[model samples]
Target: MIETEAWVLYERSGGSESALDSDDFRRETFAFPGPAGDELLVEPLFGSWEGNMTHSLQRRPIDICKQRGERRVVIGNGSVLRVLRAGADVRGIHEGDVGILHGGHVQDEFGYTVLVQGYDAPGTVGVLAKRTKIAARNFLPLPLESHHRLEQWAAFSVRYLTAWSNYHLALGAYRLQVNEPLDPAPFVLGWGGGSTLAALDLARRAGCRAAMVSGSPQRLAELARMGIVGIDRRAFAGLEFDEGRYASDPEYHAAYRAAERAFLAAVHDWTGGRGAAIVFDYIGAPVFRASVKALGRQGVLATAGWLLGMQTTVNRAIECIGRHVHVHSHYIRRADSPKAMRYAEREGWMPQVSEIYSWEEIGGLARAAAAGRLRSYFPVYRVNPV
Candidate 1:
């Protein structure tokens, strides 16, 4: 066994996010066994700072703090790794190869991800350590001749696959309603955090008119530089659809209606009055109402990210058939992994990073992400030397 130092989250922040500052995240020594049974001994290079990490730390929705009766876990979803040794049963991956590590731990019968490694899965350690031994199935080897930096690939790890899957599913749902070829490609509007930008990038590449709604002026400019329309999210400020507030507060109801009107008007103006054919939203509850209302007839609202809040009230009777709006929401499909990696490798679908934090400052990073103060859509952190 080799002694390794890993950042361990011993306690959860519970329901409140302010408790994230507690001394629960600290470094501890660990013993990692040699690779066996399709396992790989790998060294983490760069780890991605998921925007929703605070949700995991807070243990509010999904308590990844412990799994399979094991308390005190090291939680990480994505990282770039350098293979030190590969088990005899491993295929394709070999010693000394560098690759992006995966987190789709277990899939459903139809290849949909039911369990994610290093987050909610049992016995699956994350990539926030100096060294780790993991199953080879979680490894996706990067090309040695790749032009993008290792850290950029680290940005892609689970994120790009997620974005690609979300994008394809949303586009498919749009096709189901529109029933047309890609001749006059649809207008795709993406609004949310990290993964949304990457998905918008995919839309831009596929000959579709792409736009991004972001409160971050820096992000707006970044997407603008890439020729995507940048809609100011601040314009739709009072559009949150809170069930209790809308019911009790008259001002909230008025503000919500006004904001929804402004948002739909903006959407129509941007898309030449046709409205968005697809609105890829992942921010969840806060923007849910405006997003769904902004859709054109038969337009689809695709979502996967739940950074702000998870639960939202949607009326089934109000959203189908004659209403002509579809909500396509799901986690990443297992089939998206390899194909998404190929797109990243061949088409350079790397994320646009804003900040890269150190391992020691990871706790602070989580707080910043929750506060939405990060300058870039894609934020990352270094684990080990590249």
Candidate 2:
């Protein structure tokens, strides 16, 4: 006999005298002693339907158990009413709570019984809770190391969204099926600092190389610090542009075009005519066509934001047939996967956070993103330890 520390309550058919021999009465009749040595059992009652009897029994198991002086009670879904009626030593459990009703299945907010330890909120009866597995530990707060590990794991799992989003685009362009090994050479592109770094880290994990085209020197330097090889205007000759001169000259537009052509030529040479697997294309339309034109057999162009403008055209059918290129645009959502956090921690790719700000400084961070002054940037919320 598999003896367990739990109790059941139910009714029997016929009168009280006939109940003992009835199958329904025997099935509904069960008892167990509490840890404090109190015997508990369901009252002798009968009902027309099994469902109704089970429902009633769930609601009153605790009450019936308490009448027997059982303070330490374990109630199943059907016995909620009895537990509520007994109302003896009732205290909710938390995610990391140990002892008491540990390893037991309880209902959450949604009325689903799951193996959850924590109470999400007070006064939430019959509501199911999120399920989490727990290990043996004395009733106490999680250790600092454990807390930090959980935080980092949660962060990385949440931040991996950017990588998965980009990967989706690449997968579609390559006409690859799920579970198929991707040819990493034709599917990786490094764009903005965060996304680029995230993509590069993902590429490394996927066993592929990545190409980065940075508009700012600081960005290139940051990538270098992350051990990502990058190419910029400074690396090549005869492809320089004077920002001041271009801004003032009568033929500024013409000079800009010439400079763009030179830059494109350098890119083409760098790729050895095979073209890039992915292009960041942050400089917008001026370089948009060049980026598309520079794609390898199955390259994807993922744009985070259009800084220049959103107007661009391509011969859809021809572009698809000739270069087999895919275009994808996206912006990061606040909730990302924890893969990103893990990558940041594992690779030490921490964003060179320009400033740490309190909640009051949110406006400043917004202004910086608007003015495009933040470097390798991200806004972090400040919370008190308490």
Candidate 3:
């Protein structure tokens, strides 16, 4: 049978008022009592209660192993395993458990500790006992080391969990509140290489039945392979320029004006009478401004790249009042998750990789990317096979 314990570490004070009024003493205390406005009364000025609670609870696994005279104690879950590994004279738990600890067995407030029983599969660990109020189940009843490796592991784990949780929450907000079903399809203006594809994929996933517009036919063809319909702009023939006349000369000036007019006319014709629902602009500020002008009421222009340039001067007050179009900037930092990437690949949303290279090839790969010779559809990974 698996065993566990829970314990609370409280700071010592001389008298009743000493306990109640001494801020320094209360500051070290992990958990405290409160009533309404008194909720703010027992705030710990030193550290978090959750950290203290986790530190206190970790002792249970260690103590239980020692008392039972067992050479090793196995802690399931990555965080607990990391903690167990850091403590001296304790045998660290390995992943490969399957039994889950019943929820009601422990207090739900802190909701951290769980006892492992055994394994269900090769790598998966199982929980046996979970969420217990019994103090005896708590183990390793000692103060954590000042520069504890376990604390570092815990901090890193919490950081990732917090980021992932925030991302999901934002996605939830989009689904429930912000997102609306778009109709008549949207005209997506794509630029650059990688981010453009990503935006197109996102719009398609968001149920925007749209046609993508790209400067490169090669990129448009790549999108087409992914079942995304595209309008290729590279197909348009270039107008002949009157090179004999300078910009100061009337003929050259007239030619430049005609070119601008021709470009705007092409854009207007391509968009049809109804304005675009969304414009995925990654080009320069001039293109972005033009995209904003082309949007109908309630239309959105999402910019993911500023590689061409960033500074765009605008009469914001006038634009906001007249256009009623929303301009948003999207900066996506690639999530460092093998699981998420694998899922994307399995779902057929992410393109299959064509090659895997050694670390030595990284510089060459960068040059290839700069030269635009690389397809940019696949994720590149530098693997050390050794």
- The digit string of per-residue lDDT tens for model 3 on 1-386 reads 22332111222223322111222111111221221221111100011011112221223112333333432322222122211111122233122211111111123244422322221111111111121111112221212332222222222222222222233333333334235453424554444444455556655664554556665666677678876666655443232233334345886656555654554465567667555555656554545555566555455555533434456655677556644444442211223232323333344333333454333453344334333355444323322111
* Cα lDDT listed for each candidate: 0.76, 0.39, 0.35
Model 2 lowest lDDT segment of ten: 39-48
Off by over 4 Å in 2: 1-160, 175-187, 233-253, 282-286, 327-354, 381-383
The model with the greater lDDT, 2 or 3, is 2
State the lDDT of candidate 2 residue by residue for 1-386, as single tens digits: 11232122223323333111222211122222231112111110100111112222332221322333332222211110001111123234232221111112233464332332212111111101111112222011222333233222222221233445565566565554223344434434554444455556666556555657666777677667666666675533333344455578758657566666766675677666766676665435545656676677656666644444456667787676755555564422222323433445556533344434443343343344434455532333221111
Query: How accurate locally is residue 346 in candidate 3, as Cα lDDT from 0 to 100?
Result: 43
Candidates in order, TM-scores: namely: 0.92, 0.49, 0.44
Which parts of model 1 are misplaced by more than 4 Å? 13-18, 32-34, 66-68, 181-183, 322-331
In model 1, how large is the Cα lDDT of residue 386? Answer: 73
Worst 10 residues of 3 by lDDT: 39-48
